[model samples]
Target: MTKEITVTINGEEHTHEVESRTLLVHFIREIAELTGTHIGCDTSSCGACTILIDGKSAKSCTILAVQVNGKNVTTVEGLATTEGVHPIQEGFKENHGLHCGFCTSGMMMRCVELLENNPNPTEEEIRWGISGNLCRCTGYNNIVKAVQYAGAKLRGDELPSTEPVFVE
Candidate 1:
């Protein structure tokens, strides 16, 4: 059976007829044509399909498109403003939070929600917040730094140097 669902995505409203079994990730990627939300794992173990549903981080792969009817969804594409990239995206770029980028989009989306709930998260908190998302390439040291960078920027603190410091 097909169900008609209306969902606002990236600040735009989209209405489509989707099968009851349509996963939110598939609907976003295939029907809505937003491919930033990746499908690394059909299982919810990998958070590559993470997105903000009504300002909360959720694995889109585990959710049905029909379940999100009349709700607001924010993909990684919506994080940027007209001015420039989102602070979280900037953090990832500045700190090299991603190497392969398969998980970067979901990581960024989760960070968005993380910062929303706690503007200033400790190093441990940042790690715990992103524990759900996995990055196969990056060692996660830089990923923690990335979230720290965004926290500083969002707090209006002086931006730290992007250059990584190494002590041998």
Candidate 2:
């Protein structure tokens, strides 16, 4: 039987009837029409479907829509503003954090949650936090740079203001 689910997405409350078996990713992408969350692997190996659930990073593909009822979800689409891009998004862009772009959303979302939880994470903490969000492209160097850039930006410090700063 289809079940009703109420969730807040990108700051908007949405109510819908979805199959209990519907994956959160499918609900976000197919029903809500938010395609920013991608489905890369079926066995939960890839973190491409990562999203901020209740201010924490969670894999949408592995989560059921009903599981997030009344919860807040933040997707890549919600990470920008009229002022400019969210620091994390800008960091990923400026640092070449993504190449194929398939894993960019997951990385950004992961870093978003990480920073919110710990704004001043060390390089080791950042590395540990993003360890689950794998990016085959760039060998994770750019990804690390992006996360650092975002951390610095969130702390009100000036970012390198350029693409791909030297190894720090």
Candidate 3:
């Protein structure tokens, strides 16, 4: 069976007729044409399909489009505004939090929620927070630093140096 659902994504309302089993991630990518949300694992184990639903982080692959009917969704594409890039995005770029970039979007979405909840998360806390999202590259150390950088920026603290640290 198909249902007509309207979901506001990035402040834009999208109405579409979708199948009962259509995943929210598919709706975002296929219907909304937001390709930033990747489909790494359909089972939701990879957290690659993560997105913000009503300002909360959720695995898009695990949610049905109908489940988010009349809800607001935020994909990675919505993170940046005309003013500048979101701190999380800048953190990733400055800290080299991503390598292949397959999981960058989802990682950023998760970080958005993490920073919202705890703007000054410790390194350990950031590690624990992003445990759900898996990134094959970057070895997670830089990812943690990226979160730290974003947290500092969000909290209006002194911004960390964006210089890339070289390792022997």
Best by TM-score: 1
The 0-to-1 C-alpha lDDT of every candidate, in the order given, reads: 0.94, 0.87, 0.94
Task: State the lDDT of candidate 3 residue by residue for 4-84, as single tens digits.
Answer: 999999999999999999999999999999999999988988899999999999999999999999999999999999999
**For every candidate structure, what is the RMSD over all alpha carbons to the true structure, in angstroms?**
0.9, 2.1, 1.1
Candidate 1, residue 90: the lDDT equals 96
Measure candidate 3: CA RMSD.
1.1
The Cα error of candidate 2 at residue 30, in Å, is: 0.1
Q: For model 3, where is the 10-residue window of minimal lDDT?
A: 158-167
lDDT of 2 by residue, 92-136 (tens): 888888889998998888889899888888878988988887788
Clashing pairs in 1: none
Task: Write down the TM-score for model 1.
Answer: 0.97
The full ranking of all candidates by lDDT, starting with the best, is 1, 3, 2
Rank all candidate structures by their TM-score, best first, as comma-separated numbers: 1, 3, 2
**C-alpha lDDT of residue 98 in model 2:** 84
Model 3, which residues run further than 4 Å from truth?
164-168
